[model samples]
Target chain A: MNKNFIILGGGQAAVYAAREIRKNDKESNIKILSEENFLPYERPPLSKDFLLNKKNQEDLFFHSSDVLKNENIDFENISINKVDFENKKLFTKNDDFYSYDSLLISTGSENKKLSLDNNLNDDIYYLRNLEEAKTIKEKVSNKNKITIIGGGFIGLEIASSLSQLQKKVTVIEIGSQLMGRIIPKQIADLVQKTHIQYGNEIILNKQINKIIKKNGIYEILLNDNSLIETDFLIAGIGSAPSVKLFEHTNLKLDNGIVTNEFCETSIKDVYAAGDVSNFYHPLYERTIRLESYQHAQNHGICAGKNIAGVKTEYTSIPWMWSDQFNLNLQLTGICDDYDEIIERGNDINNGVIYFFLKNKNIRGACGLGIAGKVGRDIRITSKLTEKNIIVDKQILADQNQKLNKLIQK
Target chain B: MSEENWIEVGSTDSIEEEDLIRFDHQDKTFCVYRLTDGFYATDGICTHEAVHLEDGLVMDDEIECPMHQGIFNIKSGEALSPPACEDLKTYPVKVDNDKIFIKID
Candidate 1:
């Protein structure tokens, strides 16, 4: 008997999981319920190349509409308001219910909005989907002074793009350092310096005292009594898992929907992946919720495999990248709970990589360099971490020594 | 200028086993790979993005793009991963007296 597989989102994870399911089970009816009207597209480029007009709207799409149609992956543009978990039925905003044998929750994440008293500026933007990105691009085309709230990846990436476009950009990070939660101070300092060198102002450890709007301009008052009047404001503080649809349900939920290694939720036939899933990582021995391109695609693939009766585990090491100006930053694995930190290749001209080691085993690696300089090393480091190899500190620090050789050993 | 248009890239010894090196001729760029068997060549830029394949990691006969970790079969130039759907345009290679050369249009 052919089963009905309903993917509850239209993002990378949803589309990839649908494709993987098709590969494993050809006869199963696959339908993708997306809130956005556009076909599932890559979101990373929205803050960088797409914002800069380097990539057009069509370029961001993962597949053409015809491809999805031909693959029998039905993509419906609708938002789900509720779910009947016991009956495996999903209710749309219009009260349309769709029954499924198996359902995947890949709802992804949403931006944390900035709130202020009497803040009624329509120019303020939060980018989470294509429409928001398009609006930002069009709104900022004639605007000059742009203020971005939050120093997270989205905020910084947008700052980089706006700066390249010759816009007066300012970044306000509430934390003492930019990206302070995960990135080390040294790396964040380098990024901050790069931003400063490019004529962009980065204000750290400052909270919004008040927001005053007159005419069409926004005068942002900081905690130190400093004021910033900008033509437009963008916020990218952080994102929380989009798990509102199942708030009243019996499914286990913490930071996200709880799932096991096989992407199995508390419910028998239901699964979760991507940014909305706090899945148990066999490698890290902890449940983590990741929001990145790699995790979305890989976790979706894993969920699809398991749904199609492959019984595969989601064990892909965490890897993500951020492109700011001319620099490329790549981080692999988790960077916490390490006893020793080793630095490799300090020259910014070449590359700089820091490895987090615990008991001589690599736990994570973070590297920054000009464009392509650090990607190869970071990739090798990810492989090394996955293999659980004990690496020597001196050899890992040597610039001339190749990390790839360690993989073979 | 030659009849077959075989441009000598470099010496085979310049590349390690199961590794690759980027070669540029005039405006055209290509990646010359050295396997345990022989040498092969492909376009230098990744099919998915505008990144140099020289910065990519080579594992056996496969080379993963540095930017997105897209894998490609060095001998066949086949894209074997997501984000990379287009196959790389491969060039015919020949080694003469320890020097590597690739046929260019």
Candidate 2:
């Protein structure tokens, strides 16, 4: 008997899992239900290259129109709001039901929106999908004074993109630094300096009191007793797991949907992946849910392989990168609770790396450089962290030492 | 068939074993790799994005892109991972008198 596999959400995780399932089990019936109209597309480029018009819509899709059809995968543009664990079925908003042998929940994450007392104006924007990105692009095409709320990755990336378009952009963050605690203060300061150097204003340690809309302009009132007016407003505060549909269900939910290392949820025949699943990590011995491109794809593959009876564990290192202006930042592994720190390459022109160490083992590593300088070392750092290798501080500090040599040890 | 078509990249000693060098001939860029077996060549830029392949780490037989960690086999130019589905174009290489030459039209 052929198994019926149903994947909810049509993002990176959903699409990758479908492909992997097809690769391992050729006879199974794979169906992908996406909320968005378009096929699965790369979300990383939406704020960077896609905003700059370097990449078109066609270039962002995971596969062509007929590619999924050729693979015998059925894709439907429908939204599922409820799941029946007892009957192994899903119910859409229209009350349509579909039974499945196995199901994967890769609903991904949703951007947190800023609620204001007076949002009479519809000029504010939040980017989560291609449609929202396109809307923001169209709205900001003729606007110059742009104000972005939140100093996270999305906020900073959008600021970088609009700043390159020669717009006057102001970033408002309630926190003390640009990125949150994941990035060290020193590195965050460096990133903040780069943004200022590129002519983008960074306002930190201030909260939004209220927003008053006037004739074709927005007056932003900050708790610091200051006001700034802008032609356009955007918010990238942060995101949370899109687990609204699974609430009040039998499946366990922590920060996200709780799962084992094999991506199996509390219930049998039900699995979760991507940002929605806070699965246990065998390496770190804790549960974590990542919202990066690499994790989504790899986790989905792991889920698919396990569902196909391959029993593969999800053990890939946590890796993600952000591009702002000409500087590229790459982070790998857990970046907290470190007892020692090692610095390598002080100059950002060549590259600068910070290794977070606990008991001499590499807990995490972060690097900032001119685009091409940091990737190789960051990759090596992930490998060292995965293998539980204790690295020497002197060798890590010295730029002359090759990191690959440490891997060979 | 023509002598002018084969472009000399560099001496075989220039690249270490299991490493690659970026060779820009005319306007086209190519990644010339020296693996344990022999020398091979492929398009310098990653098929998924515009990142240079020389910055990528070279495993035994695979080259992982520095940008997104997408990997490609240096020998056959086959894309081995997601985010990079399209295969890279492989070029034929030959060595003569310790000088590595890639046959390009």
Candidate 3:
């Protein structure tokens, strides 16, 4: 008898894992349960292209309905209510029970809500998935003054995009600089400068105390005893793992559902990936949960292979990208534990590439405004091994030096 | 006279091994780099944005975009990274009597 694989959640992780499982196990019965009633689509474009109406929903879809039907994969748009790990069965909210030989939880994440009084009206928005993006785009047309509650990547990108649409965008960040969690202070200032140059206003170190809606307009009260009137409000606070379904299960939960390198949870024959899984990183030497597209896809790939009886570990380098205005940003590896930063290129005129060096080894890199112009045929090894190689910041700034030469010695 | 395509832009000794040089020929910018194996040529401008690839660092057989760290294959002109989906154009170059001649057409 062929084994049956049941994957919960219908985001990128679930979709990619299902594809990889089918690739290795052709005869295995694969079923996916998604809470949302749509096909697996790329969520990265929700803020960039899709929100701007540059691309439609069809373009963001990763696997079409036809592909799902052709593969004989059963996809149900129902939310799961409970998971019985010992019995290997899942109970959905629609009163459906699914028995699986193996199960994968890819239930991505949900937007973090704000702690505010009930005075705010319906004009406030929090962007997470496609539905919220569509609603924001629809409401943005008539909105004049838009106050973004967070200065993270999503908030900054939305500000950039809406400012291009001629909306008065103001970003309220509790931190001193934008994107301070991911980028350095200097680079964050540059990103802030880019937003400012485009006529967007950023209010730093200001906490939103309260929001009062009156007369079709919202008055935002800040912690600094100031008030600002806005037509609409957008909250890009953060995201938390969607692990409510697993509340009754025996799955180990840390910041997220704890999983090993193989994406296996504490329960036998059960796995988790994407934003819901707190996976152990070999490079970082700790369990970390990433909410980016790359981590979700990689987790899905690893979980799929393991479910198909192929033993593989998830050890790919962690990388992410963000497009705000015309500035294209890409980051590779981890930079949280780095001691020093090696800056390359002209920060003001050309672009900038930052190397996070730890004990003379390159551990991570962040590039701004230079993604499209770079070559694509180079192999990026773990920066751990590149420590022995000698590289000068001046030589790296030179446009003529080939990257391959830096790795040869 | 085919517009005399052969122009002595630089001498072989002008560039050392693993060094890249930017040259302007016929109002077009070309970045010339000497590999351990051979010499390679590509567009002076990066395909992603305005950052100059001639200012980028070359490693293995590719050059890291100085601006965004996007990697490109020096030999094939393929973008090996994101943000840059387009490939750079490669030109043919030959060394005759210590002078470097690049084929424009």
Candidate 4:
């Protein structure tokens, strides 16, 4: 009898892992379960093309039924209540039980909810899946006063997308600067200025204390006793990993489900990937959890390959991208522990790429606008820190210098 | 060397050393650059978008994409930037005396 592989959570990571598994083991029975009914779609476009109504729902899907059929993978649209670790069975909310030789948890993540009152009726929204995005797009009208909570990448991208639709968008962020966690102050200022130029109002250093709905309109009160009325409220604050399903199981949990380098949980024959798995990172010398799409897809592929009897370790440089109001931001490597930043290009009109360097090496890179223009430069910069190569900041700034030459040294 | 495969592209006087030029052959765009060492041929279209690499400024040994400003290596046709996730195709070039010829295949 062919072994059965059961995968929970049908997102990009889950889909990619299923595909990779089928590639290596063609006869294995693969079943993917997703809470959402839709096929695996690209989540990155939810804030950009999909939100702007420029692209339809069909355009965002990564794979179709024909592809799934050809690969002989079964997809189940059901919510999993819990996993029976000892029995090797999964109990679905629909009262169905399925047995598997191996199980992968790729439940991705859900939006972090605000602590305010549940006055969140139809007017308020959280953009995560396709349904939420479509509902918000259909409800928003011209000249609608939109209040978005959070100044992170998703919130800013939604602000840019909504502004293009001629909506009066106001972004309320508790942090003093926009994208405070991901980018430096200088680059964040450029992003803030770009949003301001696009006619979007951004309120920083303000926290939303309460959300009150009166007469079909939502009034948000800030921590400073300031109130703003809007037709809709969007909370893009952040996301928490969907790890509650494994609460009863013996799987270890740190901020997320603690997994080893091989994506194996403490429970035997069980693994986790994507946002749910907090895998150990060799570079950071700790277990780091990433919520980016690239990390999710990479994690899924790694977990899938290992589950298929191939011994592989997941260790790739973390990378992510954000499209906000004509700015294409690409970041590679971890930037949290960087000591200094090396700026490349002018910050006026166009944008600049910042290299987060430590000990004369590139630890991380944040490119705003045309930062990725020099492809070789970005690739070499990602390794500068790890390889312990000495680089002149001026040479990197100068467009005349060859990046390949710099890396060759 | 052999002038049989070399087709007369343009006058040698028309293109100076270290200058880049564009030419059409068999409906495909080709960029001809006269480096200090010799001449080389590469796809004119930027790998990121349909922007022409000929319109972009050339620095050192690479050409910047005109649309999103993605840089590419002239010799290897490797995209050295983001936005463009692919590489351009490079073609062999031969110059006989004063005539320039680009290999189509």
Candidate 5:
């Protein structure tokens, strides 16, 4: 019944939704408003491939610009300034008003630029999109000393990538551990060790006090009274949801735009997906705002199917991965709020396995590699965690027993 | 190079613990998977990105990409989950006793 479907933000969510909508309803006009000039591209490669020079600009794009023409989808490189819910339309920065029968708010998150007390703040860079990655790539060349702020996924990924290019990397984290919010502390410590093993300095439990430029270099003072000099600074402190357009609108907002299981926002005839959605996940039985490729793709498909009159619910399990050098760190389900943490392998090197147990069941797991078998184990136990199946704690902690056999009911 | 389309990758013992082994024939790479049930073969690289499937981990008949956790069905070379969209090219597996062979076009 909805003919004109307008999607805001031109990331993975918008692209996937456009594809799904086109597959179901051919006659509906699909328009995507993207702030970036480039086509929808893969964000993961920005810190990995784009930095390593393994992937070029063409490789970054998910589809060619002609894809819009071929797929009969309307894509415009324009920023959406405001949403007019009263008129069922949205206003662009160019003063263009777009009316839609149905709207999808896929506007992803933006990099939270650190508000530092220094005039040399302009010298620091943050990698969120292709443009910023390109800028960092240009700046990183022939530059030896690099000070990275924050120890999150983005910060760490960029750290490992820059260190691969043989730059003296120093990662400064305010937290005592890396990836503290997601993985367990033991795993975070192992990651820090791995970085140190790779000849990168990791200074934790401290942050920048202030910064200034001295003789074409950045001299950063830390809260611990220590000093660091670097060619430049790259801060991946964190990200905030791109919900600025919803200030005047009646759309419910929290960490992000709130959505139901069907990826439908509180507002009727409007939906939300991707990183910008704080969706009520069926598995977790709570509202979650996930920033991952899997959720974006699945949520987009679910929202598109719902928009096309299909009653599809997004129920995919949340999983995340990080590649540091030869190590593969993978986690399935949430690790927080577990009653006990069962650890196997050496927590220092060759990886360790942390089975987050609650109620005598493996609710989730994190695998770090000194050996490369944790990912497979996570896959075996992920179903158990999702289904809330009770597992023998001893069997789970035992490395000799096959996880696949233990999981068999 | 061998008799007909079947080319011996090595013995069945060569693949240890469900590790995906990459075998090359002509100009294409095929990932030979050893599962608890049986042997399977598919395109070596991930359908999502240009990454070797052998670099990923294999559980049962599913291969998870190392770059992203995109899974692929080893028996049919079907892209089972996201980040992955296109189905991989599946090749027939013919295990001759201890020696295993893959049939690729």
Candidate 6:
């Protein structure tokens, strides 16, 4: 039977879902409702190569016009203004209503802006899409001093971009360490140290009080009564899931739209993927929300296969990576509740691999500045973690023992 | 470039059963595999990222990437799984008695 598939928000997850659906049921009508004018593209390079002038705008795009046309997928520049899940009908921003046999929501997330008193500021930028990244990159060339508020992954990434341009960059963090929530303190300190070593002024545990623009320059006041004057301001504070469309529908919403192991939402014939899904992962044995490139891609594939009658469950261990300066931080699984940490390298920058354990078994593992042969072992730590067994602490800590030997028993 | 397109990597005896070995030429890296069907070669780095396939585990006819667990067919160099959408670059391998040669294009 032929089906009509409608995917909301054109991003990695949306594109993957459409591609997966096309791969299985070629007769299905696939329509992608994208808020952006361009088709689904890669978002990772916004802060790295694209912002630093290494890659052009066209290079960041994942699918070309030829590919989309060949796949028989239609890409529309529109947003979901309203949804009628009972009849499986959704209205676009242009008031165009359409019904679907299967609906996949991949609205992703929106950036959080500063709550300052500056009513209308022209120089402030928040990078949530390729267009914003392009605007910031163009503004970077004419500005000498840049101030970035919020020191999370997005903030640190933009700092790296400004650093590449040799701009006087200052990062203000409300937390004591950078990326504290995502990683352990030691790892966060390592990332902070790398940025500092590159000659950027990093201020921690400080909050932005207000923003006052005078004489074409922005004056940002800190909570401690200190003032910072910069030519422009960029906000990378954080992001929240875009779940307004699903809120009216009766779909369960926790931190995001709730989904089961198969990426199916509370309602039937409806699914959600990417950053907008707060899914119950069988691997973690808990309901976790992940915002990453790999998770979205994997979820789309899994959901697509199941929609095609394969019945695949997403039980893969969660993983994320961050590139700061010369440091490559790759982490697997969740370590927030671990009781013990076993580290091999003395310093984080030189190269260190830390394994977190709760009951002598692996809970999670992270490696900083470790690559090549040594990195291959650390990369598979998540696999051992998923085994749900225990390896000797001595063997896991010992750098001499091969990774295969440690997992054999 | 190398004076010869085909460079001798090592002895065929060094290629063990069900093992992935890495060798670098110029600035590029390639993985040499010895499976049940015999020897095959592919680009060293995972198409999803830069992790080397030689560091990954080989099972049956498929090799799993260490970074994300994405699998690839050793014989065809086709990315058989998600997280890796692009097919790996493969090279023709020749065995002259004890010497193993890879034709680098």
Which candidate, 2 or 6, would have the higher TM-score against the true structure? Answer: 2
Report the C-alpha lDDT of model 6 over B1-105, residue by residue, as the tens digit.
464877888998887777778999999999998887788899999987677777687767888886556789988989987556689989988878878888898
lDDT (C-alpha, whole model) for all candidates: 0.90, 0.90, 0.78, 0.79, 0.83, 0.81
Off by over 4 Å in 6: A120-122, A347-350, A370-375, A404-409, B1-6, B11-22, B25-29, B34-37, B43-88, B95-99
Question: Model 6 chain A, poorest ten-residue lDDT window?
Answer: A370-379
Lowest lDDT block of 10, candidate 1 chain A: A115-124
Kindly provide the TM-score of model 5 when superposed on the true structure, using C-alpha atoms. Answer: 0.89
In candidate 2 the C-alpha lDDT for residue A214 amounts to 89
* Global Cα lDDT for candidate 6: 0.81
Pairs that collide in candidate 6 are: none
Q: Please compute and give the TM-score of the first chain of candidate 6 against the native first chain.
A: 0.95
Chain B TM-score (model 4 vs. true structure): 0.86
Summarize candidate 5's per-residue lDDT along A1-409 as a digit string, tens digits.
Answer: 5489999999999988998889898888999989988789889889987899988888777677787788899899888787888689888777889999999989999999888765666888999899999999998997999999999898999999999999999999999789877878888887888899999999999978889787898888999789999997999988888998896689999999999999888789999999999999787789888888777888888888888778898877777787777677888777886898887666424346798887787767888874344666777767787777887777777777656554443
For model 3 chain A, give the 10-residue run with minimal summed lDDT.
Answer: A373-382
- For residues A153-191, what per-residue lDDT tens digits would candidate 2 score against the true structure? 899999999999999999999999989857888788889
lDDT of 4 by residue, A1-409 (tens): 8999999999988988898899889898999999999989878878888887777898777778999999999998998797888899988777789999999989987888876666464455899999998888877754489989899999999999999988899999999999898777877898899899999999999988888888868888889999899888888888888888877778898878888888998888888899887889776678988888778777988988989988888767777777777666767787777788777877533447788877766778877664334333555565565565778888877756655555442
How does chain A of every candidate compare to the true chain A by TM-score?
0.98, 0.98, 0.94, 0.94, 0.95, 0.95
Descending-DockQ candidate ranking: 1, 2, 6, 5, 3, 4
Candidate 6 residue lDDT tens string, A1-409 = 6788898889988888888888888798999999899878777778877887877888777778789899998998876799988988998677789889988888998887776765745557999799999899888789988999888888898898898789989999999888877788887887788888888889999998888889978888899999998987898888888997777669999999899999899999889988999999886678888888888888877877767667889887788777666666778888786889988666543457788998787888877863333345565586688787687778777776656644443
Off by over 4 Å in 4: A348-350, A370-376, A383-390, A407-409, B1-105
Q: Compute the lDDT of residue A374 as modeled in candidate 6.
A: 31
Candidate 3 — number of clashing residue pairs? 30
Q: Score the docking of each candidate (DockQ).
A: 0.72, 0.69, 0.16, 0.12, 0.27, 0.34
Tell me the docking grade of candidate 5. acceptable
Mind giving the per-residue lDDT tens digits that candidate 3 earns over A235-337? 9988889887777667889888999999999998988999999999776678888888767877899999998889988886676767788776767777677
lDDT of 4 at A162: 93
Give stretches of model 1 more than 4 Å off: B1-4
